[model samples]
Target: MILAVLLIAVQVAAQDPRLDRLDPDTRAQVTAVVDSARLAGLPAEPLIQRALEGATKGAPGPRIVTAVRRLSVDLGTARAALGDGASVPELEAGVAALRAGATPQVLANLHSVRRPPLTMALSVLADLVASGVPADSAAVAVLALAPKARDADLVEFRRAVERDIALGAPPAAATSIRVNAGADVLNAAGPPPPGPALPRRP
Candidate 1:
């Protein structure tokens, strides 16, 4: 009876199609994470579940591997906090929320805030940084004011760009300001100087 049960368990494990779906690199990373978790006296099953949940939720496979790697570093802490009963989807949700700026205290409150489209938010934030706003400042400003921003709020954000430029802030700083504001605001504020025009050929 014991031999038959062991054979069935092995067959079930081998039949999981998702294990075969992972690319070679991702499989290696996942295996490494699972091994580390086992060594840490944590069950490997939860980590595997988290990876599968992330995959089902449309997170890239590389990101799933990265998340598991991070989890492996503190497997004991994770297990203590999350409990052995936590499902893979719950772990993925918690990690994603944390990365999105939810603190441990505020993490439970996340259900109240309507999440903005991540792609658009990232694009806008990146543009702000590229425009000359300091990355730290730009990130803060956008997060604080994004919900309240009107067309005119964008105008004010632009004014900050002009102020930064006039103050002789570096090009990178200026880019950050533009990111917090908007490109149209910068255009209206007037363009920054052109790089030295082609030297006249005598």
Candidate 2:
């Protein structure tokens, strides 16, 4: 009986206390969504965090629940594109990529062209798209660099794009010019690393 009590205490303690800030009904709803996501082998913290962010922003309860539900779906979609080997940050970044207008095929193709730990590349892709670069152009630019650009290179590339846009260049034109300049040598570094690594043939 004592052991059972301790186990129950452990389980209660394991729950995130910040969730208590939510109304009981909203808390239960969000918890159900998070639990479902957890069972599906996806990260749950992001969903909880999304809920908390909504609550903090003074969003309506229904809105918070809807956002969490949508994010859960987005995470699953990202996982399918990135595969099981992807880290939580990579998956979250993939969610950002999708939200920023990148297609699932682009995400999957990124998985094929790049090695694991795709967080930086995914982040830059999302940033470019969100900054108004056309999604196809953003994906093209990112895929061009993913082969040989280091994390630092991606950061610099994003900054350069931002600068050009700030200087009145069209987003797509900026992305295209920068990619050609930065990736010319890297693209010639030999084709993508071996193996069939994605969801589609293309």
For each candidate, the alpha-carbon lDDT, in order, equals: 0.52, 0.86
RMSD of each: 16.6, 5.4
- For residue 162, what is the lDDT in candidate 2? 91
Give per-residue lDDT, candidate 1, residue 71.
65
What value does the lDDT take at residue 46 in candidate 1?
64
lDDT string, candidate 1, 1-202, tens digits: 9768655554544444665566667766786677656555565676677678777787888898987777655445323444454344444444443444334333222222213222233334445555555555545555544443443554466567657776887745674555645644544666445455543211
Q: Against the hidden reference, what TM-scores do the models get?
A: 0.32, 0.85
Candidate whose TM-score is highest: 2
**What does candidate 2's lDDT look like per residue over 114-153, in tens digits?**
7777899999999998888998999999988987787888
Alpha-carbon shift of residue 123 in model 2 (angstroms):
0.5
